[model samples]
Target chain A: MLTAQSTKQFKFINIDRVALIAAAAGLLSTFAAGFVTFKPNRIAAGEAFSLAASVPLQGFLAFLALWILVALLSISGIRLEKQAVFTSICGGSLLLLTFFLAGQYATAATLEHGSISRISPGTGMWIMVFAEVVLLLNAVQRGGERTRFVTALSAATVAGFVFLLLTGHLNDISIMKEYFNRQDRFFSEFKVHLLLATSSVGAATLLGIPLGILALKKKSLDAPTFFTLNILQTIPSLALFGILIPLLAYLSARYSLIREIGVQGIGWAPAVTALTLYSILPIARNTYAGFATVDPGALDAGLGMGMTRTQLLMKVEIPIASPVILNGIRIALVQAIGLTAVAALIGAGGFGVFIFQGLGQAAVDLILLGAIPTILLAVAADGITNWCIAVIQPRGIR
Target chain B: MIELVNVTKEYPGTVAVKDLTFEVGDGEFCVLIGPSGCGKSTTLRMINRLIEATSGTLLIDGTDIRDYRPEELRRKIGYAIQSVGLFPHMTVAQNISVVPGLLKWETSRIDKRVGELLDLFGLDPSAYKGKYPRELSGGEAQRVGVARALAADPSILLMDEPFGALDPITRESLQNEFSRIQRGLKKTIVFVTHDIDEAIRLAARILIMREGELVQYDTPENILTSPGDKFVLEFIGTDRALKRLARLPVQGLMRSALSVVLSDDPGKVEKSLAENSYLWVTDNEGRLKGWLDRKVLDKAPFNMEDSIVRIRVADFAVSPDSTAKEALSKMVLAGTSSAPVVDNTDLLVGEIRLADLLEA
Candidate 1:
């Protein structure tokens, strides 16, 4: 008999072909595209510079060395399957090096061109960011230990960047300059952004869970309930916010208590309300699907074992369906985080204020000050919820 | 004891069970057998209130089952099904301890009971206790299912085609183990199955149903000999006699064999075989060695001492726990009229003759 062990052959490099292709594309872009653009003033067209010309010689050499090392590892006779932690740490460090070099290049360009010049990361830097994201995703796909390694590595990188910013090492960068100019407002806006996203998701959970259960129990309600939530989702975020504003304004004008509680038409209340409506579809749909897909045999067994309806729901159905439900919550949370950025249009006081101001002035660095953190928040929320789903899920099912 | 009085279960446009009435005495293994959709399963479910009867009275120990809450009633009645339904997320020990835990059994008591039940089902408690259902083989999962059902030591058990999903060989072995467990526990069991042979093998009294109505209700022997109707007779099939033999263990028909020690003097052994035609030789521990034929011995130029003891072949002996049908088949294969019966330890207990089996 030919056993699996006997038939198996060892492979040297275990990296995926797609990852290799992506890495090559990333390295090519650094040589072909501008690493940073330096403008004499915010309104002027900037001069583009290659990665080698933009950063110091040492930083550029370090970047090239890191890329070469990654390329070599991709093809070398060394398997990373068992050494995922090492692979992730190596990949993460490469990402950090790229970011650090980009920041250094921005600072160098600003100082060299005089203080009046503003420097923004260029096409090559964006390509590098995309490549780093792909590499991180690949590490995450390895699952279990690799995912944990990648998550920890990401956290460490973020912490290191924050430390550099606090120590004034990155103050010369245009985005950091924008942050320093409105430091107090930026902090407040960050809090408000979080508050909007969290409260909306919280409200959605409270409403959607019961609706989902009701839809499951009363089959007649399933179609209509889901349709309503789906329609709510289909409406554009701006239009939904538009609708909530006038409705809330009328209610607050008519009721003293509504006004007293700060339920104004153009603030966090309307923003959160719109977001909550948008969040319902994913939350409710996944809950219903998870409950519906529960093993019928297990349900029968639970009922036969004398578990009451509530006990069965709490002990068996909910626990078995948790991972799916949490996945739904993850989708809703990430969506809400991204959508809340638009709430600043309604004076909701979040990072979107800088985004709009940057757009009006055509200031790329100012826009990135808001956009980068918003993207990071979404990614962080997605990762945390995924971890929760993995943790709370019962064994054997996975 | 459980009694169903005029129980009828009606679905939207059909009656699943119609005017069904039956009484199972305490400790009786009552098997409900029928074609699919004959309401046998529906009857079993109605007893546990998994399906409520449209109109009927179900009594357990002379008290109406409806008087108690369904959850409370179910907790008191053990239930198992064809799928086993061992919770995939829970360990075997946890699955077995479900009802006991629900009934507020102390942690230590539930643990002890789980160990005891695992042992009764022939599973090593320590080895199987922590295993999830997915880790278990089909037969082992089914055993755990049964062990779980019996965990709380309920006075009654309801099984719905409990071994229906198993392969033939595993099914037969499980049936034998089930019989042993049933005999030891003596719970008032109401089992449902479509397999007439399985019904005959395990049922003390068999209730045959046809299209939601009772066709026959009697002991296995009576059901085979005097089926109540054409449906009942046809349902039992033409191999009634063979199936009857399946119900009788070899131990029931086995008789004490005329034997001699393996160390017996060859002349005496030959003389004894000469009188009996055949003589069984046993070791000091009473385990069978082999038989000596008088005619073969008489014609042999064999040394008397060397020829006295012969090694027994595997086919020449059957376990006492095996069915008479199994023994008969072995006898036919070995081309012998009789075979020695051994226990689990391979100690010879008695002999079963083909003629004696036919007579029984």
Candidate 2:
């Protein structure tokens, strides 16, 4: 009884660990690593600037304001639910401002030095972004999920980014300069990259979902089907591309039909095919798992209700299993986006063209020009799919 | 009417049910009961073609079962089970509307019917219709389960221990509610349960089974007085007479209660006590608060309502809807020949006595 009474009194000290970690990480990174690197030339080693030196008075004050806001929110004894929502909002704002601050610093430095000088986000900027992401993820896990508030916040963030781009606030950043130089080529390559990823995953969805259902239905086909897909997945991407080149060259060379369909030794045909093969396991396994784990009682009840087999599958089984299936699709999509860069190895055009070019020239800003957008695309896909899954799920079960 | 002739379900090696033959009369509440492995669940499923019998000439409403497509035939009958198999993704209204929707009933008609069914189960339609199955308590879920079964208003209902998973109090109350619902619907119900008390309380006719063969099919009264064999006797247990009292509702044995409102004229308590020395005390809502001893009250100030001997309903009262056996147990615990009967909300309604119950 005495212990219980003491424990009740001590309950006021419940700490929000996620907020503390995010704040601590942000503070540590600000001091340990500078916020931006100012370069004399495209390929020269740059001088890094600490947070205080990186931006002018207003920008520095703005950072201090956001930090104080976060600190206050962390220490205040608010209800966990409200605290989580506010904390995530603050995290989102902090992320946007960090990039904006770097952009402002870049523009100011370019004016002071010369047009030839370049500025890039440094390690501290990356760490701040990471911290904010951790903060946002923690909030979502704790309380912010499935609410229109979060969705609206995501929309506002996207709008803010578009506004920043349109206003040319970020123009002086080195990566944006790379983007402007190859704007036309960049757009076309971006389309090709998206198309490659989409078509392969789409084809896989068409083939793999049925295969998954079939695996569950035909017990005999289960092992061999997964085995083949597993073997396809185990082959290194480069090795698979290499193997496909020789095989496809021979087939296309020997057959008019293969040549007519553009099944060449290198390029999109093998890239897409490899990507699709990589995608099938996640989609099919998740599909199989989704259907296999439906409550037996529900199936029995559905059967007893006199639903035809097709009706049962359509109306009951599919809806219950949709979230799991979509989760698989999400995994496949993010993975496909990442691997599409590797497809550039076999002469497939994508952001990887710039990446490889940057690697050849030993230019870090040029590499960031390709790598940053690819990372953003993956993050966007994950966020969108997560929203879709949350919307599709029934409130009671979730 | 459902008729099964030589119905047997044979797995690879074992015969789950063997040569089961029976004819359930129209509108009859026939209970198929026995220990586990008695194939009662299998037999119930076979009615809906959930499990195909190895060989049988099964007829429903004077037609061979195989003549209709399995799905089409199952649509014409209502089915429920112990798990209450409500679709978690669907709301109560949608779950109940499933069969009706399959039959392509108009939307307005389906909505009205869903509301009616929800109201019939005593769940407020607006409050419960939009709720998902996971949101409901076990008893509420089972209620919705039965409501969903009756949605299409089929001529027959098949239940496999629908209330079996609930707590004892909830189970008993649900059984009473089901009995009341069954009485009104008059739908042919083939219920499967292992509880002999449940079978006795709800079933109009009982089919006793052992080792997947029919042991006896008879009325509850006959089954209680005479058993087919030692197995049936032991299955029903040794307290045959006590179990039989469960069939008699307390309301049937209840007399007009000698109850007085506490704020009523002081003279009325003494006048009411002349007929019975034990005076039941009630409040304005007709809820039993306590009882008054006439001899003790005679010397005390009549205005002393707090001085009345408090009788908690849980310790000394019986529900009007409860069985005589339940009331008898309560009466025995309270050491009284007679007990005050209350409604579900414990509003005093009448009185039942040990003598009256025994006479009945």
Candidate 3:
């Protein structure tokens, strides 16, 4: 039979868990708002505005309210609620801050018509404001029941304030609405850009890892392959794109094969190819780093125990070096996202569309439409990647 | 039984082990020992084919071990290293069950074997079965390593400096416990270490190596009494006599002349004294009390029937396993020429004298 205390502990559990639940629910709400058509009377882009404005605002505000409550509770010295509240506040706030800063640039240029970026600071704010509470809870759980609640609460409050920024929903949030209203046509284009950027990064990882392993295992292959990759990395992105344009045109004209394969210019394909080319360094470099770092003695031990070469690689070396490789992959992923945004300049479909189109039309709000999500996407990609790394690293290492 | 004939291992610059020849008899506790870089480890590793011997004919149970697949040979020969290479990801039980599990035993059988091995090593299966290697103390982890080696019941066991990292007290106790386990199991064992005392204590036949060559291979008593060369003699050093004491039992040097005194009655004398000038007094059931004053008989007719005065608990003697160095140190510190010796029941065994200790 579980006691009430135990039940409460089960509920409160880890702040990250609570933050996960809150953030997940918040993301789901955002997703729902994206799908549903809403009606806002007397709005320009009438049906589109009705479908977009209030639903995202309401969902964003709800998410914001959760973080605000978490921040307030953390500030008020309530320890029990600190972890979920603090992590949500801190982690969410940092994410929100990142989004806000990126949104400021996006809106100033008119890529968006409204302050969607400024709307919800997200769980990052809550997580940041009450980080101490989360740490305190961790300590109490580890240290035993003799610990005072106040110690944890105060610790949570203190940790939350570590990354404090006084500005919130002040200048940028107000400007956000005006920015979105001006660039109403570009929001949907931004989504496709994000999808292509992410998928291409994933595609780069798939190709890079096996090549890395082969280079590591075969010495004869290592130098030549590495030189080729180094040369590839050294080529300027703009030059690479310029080179690809002719290559793509030749393939499309000569073969009549590329069109069926979705190789259209001013579309997803070229953007993905460009972004993927930018991603190889982190993956290949990390893979090499990971394999090189495996202890020779540990390898010897496995081999001495009669492990086959393949078995040794799979069972010992790979498991031990996974974190390093993952770190490399993460770096590649971030770089890819940033570079992919540049693909929009070439009319490759993405958030880049709004920025390029806005620049052409001299509409700052349209530029904001594309640039804001790109920045937000980068932050989201980073947070999710970091979380994944944290999860993937063997508990044994820590 | 295992045999190594003319085994030599040559590396790029130097030979790691050279022309080593020895035989581990059935159920024999053979120990290989030497200072670092002496190729003792190189020799131990070669037996399991971890390192290929430059030239040798190795036999296990009178068959060439090299003929068997290395993995197959290892499966049949339990091997443990100095660092206790337990898989960090596995639980204690899982670590122990590795070899047996590798043998493809049924899950229930493997579980039973794990339980038995843990219990044999004094680790409760229920308490420690699910614990990771990091959770264990240094001593406990080493014990688990030994348990894991024994899991498949391989007739041949190889242990490489198993207790090398432990503190002296723990090392001693574990040595004794492992010796007891070995005595019961009687598995043909080849233990390796740099610690000469450990070699002497654990080995039935000790082989000393130096710079990849077999320097001396003999019984512990023979090695100490007559070292083969300057290297062997210098290795044992001036501590030869102390090392000799380690081989002898406590019964060989305990004090016998104990003066008895009464606990309840202080002044009376009708005690039995033939050639004994002193008596070791006891309260009840041979529990030690301080010795009676032998000269008190001259002053008054005193009987130590009831009254006993404990001058100090340190003044009396203890068990036989207490080493000569310890007994000698206690004697010098207590300023006593003699000390009584007793067993676990507190029954008087003998007396330890300065002369007796010096003789030892």
Candidate 4:
């Protein structure tokens, strides 16, 4: 009777509706879509395999059991914190288990069919990965200990993947095979990717903050300033990079100063210029908004109390507006990270090298090698900046 | 002393203040009162140079205000406003120490001054010094605003409706507090407000303005009793006499209290009760203890302990500094014809009668 009474309260209590949808989708994909795909060579159409194909019976049962628990936790009448924690743990385990099963089958196939054969994650595996990520992120964001919990979960996931890699468990996976072949090139390209993005964003911030402050100081500059920046942003990153190539080549060819600075037609010079130009709009616009939002009464009182313009800007304006200003940098950073992937097309090497290379050769695993890490890097950068904003924001604003 | 000569502030489309001339003596609590847009606030801002007069010779201590740099002049004149404007990021102590820090005072001096100002405003230093402005109530934040203004102890203060944003109960208590504090510090203050009651309560001299011009300037008593013009007459309101009486402090109107110590002769107390009907009881130190009615003495040879009805000092006594209006209201609320007047320590010093308030 007590159990029945408690179960009835589920309708009235806050239901984890998004979790319900994700878990249901996860279950459907598990039954209908292939667990993995097998190809005799890198470029051939692959054969799909469901769970019963080669997954160990015991391991299969455990995956199903944990998946059901994850779904049940979503609907059960439990404390919110407990629900978040349990769902996250179960969701994380399911992701690792799915990958482990794929890795196991890939190894078995590679030994029989010889090393040139490839095993890429199929539609079902990708859908399952998506569902698990959504559940994990939802749980993390809803919890009170958002930053600390996210950091711990990410660290644990990284450690788990590294343990699998060092033990040769995932060596035969198609993406891992691609990684091993191009390990040195991959590391160099990753370095280039991060350097290009960060340097561009750094330059944008240095210039954009003052531009924003200038717009805020002079009402006449506001429309014209935003107009120019908006136009620059509207130009697609690819098109902007293209435009910079000819313009920089012309300038560097004529001026020794430009050539001395290593400005080039198709290298980091054009890439950095295009990226920095693209980054400035968000920073400048948000800076203007942040400073504009400061209370006018505070400015009046500050001036009335004998603060010089510099003193007011430093002591009163900056501290109060810092959180909003940092938020602009966060936006600029995320944009620059994604755009830097495109820079590899013009000989500025990054993770984009593998993506464009994979596209030319029609190699799905090669594309995954480049694409997955880029996505993760963006998420990590976003998390770090958000944590900064939370830390520095004034208690009064809270 | 500060003087303004032929000061005018003209915008392109309008004149905010025109040909205004006034002198505020040192240590004066001067209030500039009028309806909104009367240029009273503009006039106050000119003294601190927050708003520069279009054409004027503003003098402080026989020196032209323009002789000193604007920031230098403002640093020497403390300023506060209705919004309080305490920095949301700064703690109470940090906010209070801003001016002193600007003036480059020593760290120890600033800390000590901040502590003293916090105590002066009745905010416990240990409890409130580290608290951000958001943590404070409206009344408390306004107290910190005033405290910050006095942090550097400037001789001149420019206040524009410093307590205008508070609820009635809080406003009254803060007003009473500021009045007491000003009586001690006595800065050359030029305060701007639209509230006439506030002017009557705080101002030693009232400057009435209308349409960028002076309507009348005089002491509160004179402004209430005599009309400089029809505008001044209408501005003080129809309850002029009551307000006048309310402005009259109970200290001047009170007579010596008729009372005996707790150990005094009961026969003598009973005898006094026949003539005055009510007799006050006090301790040897003169702190008010109780009261007696002749009816309580109806029992022949009344016991001193039995006949002395216990009275709580808060319920039975009024402060001597309180206006006649406050004493009358207390007497009416307690259903009595008179109330004993006391000092800050609640020592009985005098008596105020309802008849005396009405006659005044």
TM-score of chain A of each: 0.89, 0.91, 0.57, 0.93
Model 4 pairs whose backbones collide: none
The window of 10 residues in a row where model 3 chain A has the poorest summed lDDT is: A42-51
lDDT, candidate 4, at B360: 76
- Deviation of model 1 at B197, angstroms: 1.6
Better of 3 and 4 by DockQ: 4
After superposing the true interface residues, what Cα RMSD does each candidate give?
1.1, 1.1, 2.7, 1.1
Residue A390 Cα positional deviation in candidate 2, in Å, after optimal superposition: 3.0
lDDT of 4 at B336: 88
By DockQ, who's the top model here? 1
| Best-to-worst ranking by DockQ | 1, 4, 2, 3
Error of 3 at A385 (Å): 4.8
DockQ of all models, two decimals each:
0.61, 0.56, 0.23, 0.57
Off by over 4 Å in 1: A1-12, A16-26, A29-33, A81-93, A99-101, A112-114, A132-154, A227-274, A343-349, B258-312, B345-349
Per TM-score, what order, best first? 1, 4, 2, 3
Query: Which should have the higher lDDT, number 2 or number 3?
Result: 2
**Candidate 4, which CAPRI tier?**
medium
Give a tens-digit lDDT track for model 1, residues B1-360: 999999999999999999999899999999998999999999999998999999989999999998999999999999899988887778899899899989999999999999999999999999999888889999999999988888899999999999999999999899988998899899999999999889988999999888899888999988887878788878999888878788788988999889988777777777777789787878888877777776676666635555553655467788887888888888898888998888877688889999988887
Expressed as tens digits, the lDDT of each residue in B230-253 for candidate 2 is: 988999999988988888888788
Please write out the lDDT profile of model 1 over residues A297-357, one tens digit for every residue. Answer: 7788778879899988887788877788889889999999999999999999788988988
Better of 3 and 4 by TM-score: 4
| lDDT of candidate 3 over B1-360, digit per residue (tens) | 999999889999999998889999999999888889999988888888888898988999998988999888887887776677776656888777767766788999999999998898899999999888879998898899888888889999888888998999989888988988998999999999988888877889999998888988999889999999999999988889778777766566664555443444343334454235656676555666666546656666565543344645444565787767667667788777777676666666666888887776
Q: Is the docking of candidate 2 incorrect, acceptable, medium or high quality?
A: medium
TM-score of chain B of each: 0.91, 0.84, 0.90, 0.89
Model 4 regions lying over 4 Å from their true place: A1-22, A29-32, A145-154, A239-270, A345-349, B13-15, B256-319, B328-351
What does the lDDT read for residue A376 in candidate 4? 85
